[model samples]
Structures are given as structure tokens and as C-alpha cells.
Target: MITAIVLIQTVADRLTEAAQEVADIDGVAEVYSCAGDVDLIAILRVTNHEDIADIVPGRINKVAGVLDTDTHIAFRSYSSQDTEATFSLGLE
Candidate 1:
């Protein structure tokens, strides 16, 4: 599975609506309104990397309130690292 995070920038007053609309897209797994430079952050899990090229620019950027998007892919998960360390230590 390929996982990516889309940092979305929206029109000044449309963060909520834009987040909801992006969340409704097929490959989106989660969406949150973040308190940072970026307006909303969306988590997407797709079957392949090519799906990102097709879905993100094609559908997400086309949403009305969306101003711009920056996507980041996971190379290594911190949560997975933590889990592995804990399990390898043989702790309950």
C-alpha cells in the first residue's frame, strides 16, 4: 500500500467545507483541520503510486476551495519503528 499526506491550502473561509469534500474522495482515509501554515491535512492510502498522480492533481486540486496542495509520502513510519522496538525487547 502507498500512503501519502496531502497538505491542503484553502480559500480563507472554506477550510471546513474543503476538508469535508476531500475526505469524501475515494482514496482518502482521514482528514483534519490543522493549526499551522497549511490549512487542512489529508491522509490518503492508495493501491499504487500512480494512483496519486491521477487522483490528487485530477480530483483534489479541482475542488473549489482548494488553493494548493503539497503531498508527502511515507518512507518509514515512526509508529512502526516504535512497535518494532517494543516487540523486539520482548516486553508485554
Candidate 2:
């Protein structure tokens, strides 16, 4: 799967509404409202890179309150669980 991290900026007053709308999009796996340089962060997982183009510019950017977006495509994923599992492979 292709994973994309999207940093979103939305109209201040419409933050909640925009987040809900983005969360409802098909390719969006998760949406988080945060306090920082960006208002919301969306996690998108799809089967192909082409889907990122269609989902981000074609849909997300068109949402009513969305002001701007910066998207990053993930090359690799590392988590504590993954690391632990790798190190403990023979312990089980």
C-alpha cells in the first residue's frame, strides 16, 4: 500500500467541519486535529501512487474549508512494535 501524510491548513472557524469531511473521504485512513503549524493531519492509505494524486488534489483540496496542504509520501514505516518483533524473532 501507499501511505501519505498530509498536513492540512483549514479556515479557523471551519476546522471541525473540515476535519470531519476529510475523515470521511474514501482513501483517508485517519484524521487528527492538532495544535501546531498545521491544523489537521490526514493519513491516507491506498493501493497505488496514482490514488494519492486523485485523493489529495482532486478531493481534499476541494473541501470547503481547506486552505492548503503539504503532502509527503512515506518510503518506510518504523514502529516500536516492529522493532521489538524484529529483535525478538527467536525468543518466542
Candidate 3:
């Protein structure tokens, strides 16, 4: 799967509504309210890279309150559970 980390900038007054709308979009796996330069972070998982292109521009950008978006494509993923297992060594 292709994973995209989308950093969103939304109109300050419409942040919640914008986030809710983005979360409803297909292929968007998760949405988070964050503290930083970006207002929201959306995790998108799709079968093809082209899907990211379509989602970011065709849909997300068109959301009413969305001001801007920055997308990052992930080549690899690591989860804390995976790391914990690696350190366990199958020990009891």
C-alpha cells in the first residue's frame, strides 16, 4: 500500500469541520488534530501512488475550510509493536 502523511492547514474557524470532512473521504485511514504549524494530519493508505495524487488535490484541496496541504509519501513503516517484538527475542 502507499501511505501518505498529509499535513493540513485549515481556516482557523473551520478546523473541526474540515477535519471531519477529510476523515470521511475514502482511503483516508486516520485524521489527527495536532499542535504545530500544521492544523491537522491525515493518514492516507491506498493501493497506488496515483491515488494520493487524486486524493490530495481532487478531494482534500476542495474541502471548504482547507487552506493548504503538504504531503509526504512513506516508503517504509515501523510500529512500536514490531520493535518490541524484535527486542523480545522470544523470551518468556
Off by over 4 Å in 1: 80-92
Relative to the unseen true structure, what is the C-alpha lDDT of residue 69 in candidate 2, on a scale of 0 to 100?
100
**Over 4 Å off, model 3:** 83-92
In candidate 3, what are the lDDT values of residues 2-47, reduced to their tens digit?
8999999999999999999999999999999999899999999999
Per-residue error (Å), model 3, residue 4: 0.5
Q: Which has the higher TM-score value, candidate number 1 or candidate number 2?
A: 2
Q: What order do you get sorting by TM-score, best first?
A: 2, 3, 1
What ranking of all candidate models by lDDT puts the best one first?
A: 2, 3, 1
Q: Which candidate comes out best when scored by lDDT?
A: 2
Instruction: In candidate 1, list every pair of residues with a backbone clash.
Output: none
Candidate 2 per-residue lDDT over residues 1-92, each given as its tens digit: 99999999999999999999999999999999999999999999999999999999999999999999999999998989878888885854
For model 2 the TM-score comes to 0.88
